[model samples]
Target: MYKEPIFLKPVFKDRIWGGTKLREEFGYDIPTETTGECWGISAHSHGPSEVINGPLKGKTLDQVWDKHRELFADQEGEDFPLLVKILDAKTDLSVQVHPDDSYAREVEGEAFGKTECWYVINCEPGAELVYGHHANSKLQFEQMVAENRWDELLRKVSIKPGDFVYVPNGTIHAIGAGTMILETQQSSDVTYRVYDYDRRDDAGNPRELHIEKSIEVAMIPHVDADFEPVLSGNEDLRMKKLVRENYFTVYHWNLAGSVSKIENPAYLLVSVLDGEGELKVEGETSSSFKKGDHFILPSTIKNFAMNGNARFIVSHPTI
Candidate 1:
């Protein structure tokens, strides 16, 4: 059994709404100037992360999940349950919605629905995004879209760095321009686009919109899903319980000194957001980590110790 942290190599994604900030801020060797996303900790078929260290080095995350099921405590899922990403939106994203589990399993034939949450990393001053709609019914929603009454239909909200937003399936939303976020999401990637600002590709073709499917999946009379994040920790280590949904639980770890004896029965997905640190398991040598590093603390590790100043976004599947 592997008892060390499984470090991962991130996979970059290019997007029309992307910019060079991913390279400028995180110092990533981005593939293009318009690199929009870093799939930091993912096992989705489209962009699975590769193991960069340990005996599993060179293996894709999906391969580990298949061959070494014990690494995850043998969690019961046909596919990896979570995906972690950092998205840099140079311009506004398409107004989109995702289907729930039942719809995804039946229609898209996917293992999971795309319910995701965002931790705002940085945003331009006075940044705002489309959160929901003011439509009272499906008919009214269709009417507003048909009329091109975007201002009246979309509900925008101001946002800033350090803010967190939970976007479940069927939530109509878009990431605004000049914004960056660390997103924790289900492994599925089924998005139904409602609007795209009439954008066109390099070939001069308008991007396709799933108007009917978007309408079918979007929540009528949008309801805000309320969450109460809890905080706990000692003086040197602070932990904020960001969200504990049916699929996964996420946390923000702020460390200044050291924490020994940290343990979790299940595996952990960890992404270092800032600063540097060293992690040491009971018998293994210490491993140094810094900003933009992502790794998995497998169940076989049992416990570990972390030292130094660092901030981390950590999550685990709900097994």
Candidate 2:
């Protein structure tokens, strides 16, 4: 049997902190207050995911996890490598931090640490994000979290479209309201959420906060970014490298015409950003996709081709 790619329709995650209706793809429920993000594809461990396309098409992401176990965090000693998600922020997210590989190994007994990057897809007026902190120690951060002095302790940065922010493991961060962010990260969803503005969940209960773990794992002494991906071209088809590391190499490929001969890579994740196109992979029937469509291509695809003009973000492991 020839294996085709997998297209995942992400399950909706309603939060006290989301805003995106997640239009175009998932028919996710919207809230009355409208202060939450529409998370597509990958989400926290709180909920499972909906697989919407490709070979693993129409299957839950967790079903795949139970069967293969090598495509996610590999907690059972498999080789699953990364996690990717789209964030639609209608309100500010809680301040939080993630553990690094060493910390995760020693403290949490996890397979890998969390490191991620965000690419701004949409930004409303005055939109911003919390990238890191100004503090030099855990004590100062704890005090800030306690006193609700986020503005003082956090390094708030204004954002616009075409901006990219890298959040390495242990970096204190949060996504602000009115911004849509595409996040690519290590497969594990072990986040240490520190603060949540006293918001309650749908059950009207205060959500959990991992303050002690957050403080212990949060990065201090901010690392300034002197690096940005070079814009490669500006044709009907455009390719911009978002981030390249051992974990993954992501590229923004825009198109209006047919793109041919892409069949080999360890794995490829195609997220349609705009327009529409028909894709032929693994000798199966071609599939049509438009804005917000996505598929996970296996390493065995041969003679793959795309018909029509459509823009998509592609991600694959660097190895």
Choose the strongest candidate by lDDT.
Answer: 1
| Highest TM-score model number | 1
Worst 10 residues of 2 by lDDT: 70-79
lDDT (tens digit, per residue) of candidate 2 on 11-94: 555566665456523344545444244334442354445676545655665567567544432335343556667777777788
lDDT of 1 by residue, 22-96 (tens): 899889999998999999998999999999998999999999999999999988777989999999999999999
Q: Which stretches of model 2 miss by more than 4 angstroms? A: 1-3, 24-58, 62-79, 142-148, 200-207, 282-285
Q: What clash pairs does model 1 have? A: none
* Superposed model 1: Cα runs more than 4 Å off: none
For the record, the alpha-carbon RMSD of candidate 1 to the native fold, in angstroms, is 0.9
Error of 2 at 119 (Å): 1.7
